[model samples]
Target: MQLANYLFFTTGCEQALAFYAACGLGEVTELKRYGRDGQPPTAAMEGKVMHARFEGPGVLFYASDNHDAEPMRGSAHILMLEDRGETARLFGQLAEGGTVTTPLGIQPWGDYYGKLTDRFGVQWMLNCRL
Candidate 1:
């Protein structure tokens, strides 16, 4: 069995994937739009991507536009907290048995930033934009 991340976007899957490629994440190997799905397209689905495969240096995932549903949450996490104490607390909790890739502290970018992988292998990123 193979495991892959699938992302659902309400719209602009193409543009989002383009941005990802620009960020050196990955490039879309194949893109299929709703209008060309061998099914009649509705006005709302005309320019939306039905499915797309993206592959890059270390990432392989699929993305699609689902006009009626909210976007799916992926393994990556970004937490923006305003409370220093709370931030530290959560950081400690997430760091329990997992590896802390980046220590939680004020970064050169002038924000409290850190990254960690939970015991379950999920990655998390925290940023307290000061």
Candidate 2:
């Protein structure tokens, strides 16, 4: 079976996806804004991301907005990559405007690693083998 990461945003899933795209995180292959299929989008759901299928170099994930303001906890998505430059670039991009729990570095275990919480409060861990 193929595995994929799914993220739920309190709001701004669309904006988050845009930010991620700018950071080279991934692209949204398909996106559906929240709305009743039989009716035109209501004002409340007009700009909210209902679901988005995101795919990147070697990763796949789905994202959507909950619109209920609930907070997410107890999970951190890990990105394992082999290209040093892309890893570093993505780490820097994800770290912008967020808390860096661990600065990217060559760890004692000999892997380039880092941790951060993005502006949307999504935690991430990145490891690169170069």
Best model number under TM-score: 2
| Residues 1-130, model 2: lDDT tens digits | 9988788886778888898899887799988876643334557666677788998887689998875755557888899988888889999999889899999999999999999999888899999975
lDDT of model 2 at residue 48? 77
Runs in model 1 lying further than 4 Å from the true structure: 74-130
* Model 1 lowest lDDT segment of ten: 69-78
- Could you tell me how far off, in angstroms, the CA of residue 104 lies in candidate 2 after the best superposition? 0.7
Q: Each candidate: how many clashes?
A: 0, 0
Per-residue error (Å), model 2, residue 96? 0.8
Q: If scored against the real structure, what TM-score would every candidate get?
A: 0.57, 0.87
Displacement of residue 128 (Cα, Å) in model 1 is 19
Report model 1's TM-score to 2 decimal places.
0.57
Cα lDDT, model 1, residue 75:
61
